[model samples]
Target chain A: MNDDDILEQAARWRSEGKGVALATVVSTWGSSPRPAGSHLAVDQDGAMIGSVSGGCIEGAVVLEAQEAIKSGNPRLLEFGVSDEDAWAVGLACGGRVQVYVEPIE
Target chain B: MKGALLDRLLAERAAKRPAALVTSLNGGGQSLVTAEETHGDLALPLNVVAAARTALRSDRSGIVEADHSRFFIRVYNPPLRIAVVGAVHIAQALAPMAALAGYEVTVIDPRQAFATESRFPGVRLVTEWPDEALGALRPDRRTAVVTLTHDPKLDDPALEVALRSDAFYIGALGSTRTQAKRLHRLQELGFNQEQLGRIHGPIGLKLGGRAPAEIAIAILAEATQVLHQGEAAEAEAAGAL
Candidate 1:
């Protein structure tokens, strides 16, 4: 929601020793609901920070963010249609996006 | 550098600065498996949640005030950062998406006309030429540089800077032919094959279309895969993360 709310929560998690992964929506196309610069924080417990698209994509992102944290691997995750993504995440509107996923250290 | 980055991000977040945190990945002395957050260390008292009234009483140095119920354990050491060169239309779409995915975004462009504060309201906009910008911008490991400027003068110099730096994601925007031409120039300028390997030309996912916004999405989407799911096949890479 608010920036401080997120900071407070992220700080609390860090202080309390909770593993957290930060996910960001780096790019989007075609009537995507969320704007770019949206931030989502996925902790080990699956708590989320900012939103990427809308309700459509966050759940999926949380799963990936958690895995990233668990695996200690950072990845660029994408959603929607492209030549390569003809059968992937496939958004409802055929909108495409860039998601950079990394485990928070 | 890591500590300062953390401090800056935490302080900015704490102060509601709304500024983006951009980390240089695998830069000199940067590690992939063990890359540290240039920012993200914001600790506050956990006891505050238990006794809301006493939050102010706690001794806070590196500590801020957070709910005592909240816990802090480093989950991911260093998050990735996306550095945008040329805050153009594509950047408008790209910056916010990068932020949404949790990547700190920094926009560098010499064009004040295009790289103005209004264009990118929430992100960081650096009104400097790419050469000077990358020096101060510091393209490190885990950091990505995308050049959207159609002009080679703008993107080329930046590519040189980005290639030389430790930035993992170095991309230049143009057609395949344009990219080849640009590469030829880069070669003439003394960029070897190894150095050229680092640059991603004809930037963005090959979406087979040409809308600015759509192109922006494609570029960032491809960048996402490279930055996030570099190993996965390009076809299966697009998904929420």
Candidate 2:
């Protein structure tokens, strides 16, 4: 799906009473997979509509998104080559990215 | 983000008005910024608002450091568009190619037989006369216009309307002699030298190919070049500060 469709889908899910969280790639450094505005929408049930990373860190982002949905608090997540979570989460492409996750009410 | 704020942002985007959603990385703050107004509950400082306007002008989204926190400026600009004032073979090849390159393509021609759906599937087909079609199209700064009919009757009318608009790129297909003749006619129409110079006659880069598809590639390459000509200036302006 394109960028617009992902946001529309998030709104649709929210209207359906499903908990939704939006994760946007706020910044990137080195050879990041996605640009700064790329989005990934995740629901409480672990369902996702788009991707912030090509495939490198969606799993980690989804986990963070679910947590944000539950806590009702936004989060600024940073993943880089030097972080162990980056390696564990498999952002093995030697790039760094900052994602902002916020719950949709 | 509140649903109401998201709706407003989407509405602004639907109306093709540029907007930015500024989110504080430290959380607990967000604001929606537009050309003449600001929305959302966040009480943004003047520097953040100025940064948002600069981001809108540059058409780039990223993090801005201000207010002792980081704000992510996510921009929403209208999609770029192209209006090809002919349904000829070059347009047939160009329409889909332009679409794939992320431009909304419209093929305009009054000839019913030439502008049929089968000839240009999935592309907007305007059967109205060239001038009327373009007048309605209202070529904006994000738009590109190309005249490929090679007939002055059809091409000239579209060229006249397109030249008057803020279209980022305007090109017409012809030889050097044909371009001189076309320029002469436009000059007679009260267009000044600089206005007439906006028409990139001979339409495309000199790829030295006569095939329709090859010519389309040349045209698209040239248009792409014209489209991105502002980036360097923007970067330079940013650097100067």
Number of the top-ranking candidate, with DockQ as the measure: 2
Report the CA-based lDDT of candidate 1 relative to the real structure.
0.63
**How many Å off is the CA of B175 in candidate 1?**
1.0
Candidate 2 lDDT tens digits, A1-105: 566778888888998999999999999999999988889999999899888887989999999999999999988899989999899998889999999999987
Give candidate 2's error at residue A15 in angstroms.
Answer: 1.9
TM-score of each: 0.51, 0.88
Error of 2 at B45 (Å): 0.5
DockQ class, candidate 1: incorrect
lDDT of each: 0.63, 0.89
Per-residue alpha-carbon lDDT of model 2 for B1-241, expressed as tens digits?
Answer: 9889989988887788899898877765788999999998788888888888888776778888886987888888887899999899999999988987778899999999899999888889999999999999899988999999999999999999999999989999999999999999999999999999899988899999999999999999999898777644674686411
**Poorest 10 consecutive residues of model 1 chain B by lDDT?**
B55-64
Task: Give the TM-score comparing model 2 with the true structure, all chains together.
Answer: 0.88
Error of 2 at B120 (Å): 2.5
Per residue, candidate 1 scores C-alpha lDDT tens digits across B32-131 of 1112222233322323222221211111101112332222111122345787888888889888877776667889888789988888897888887888
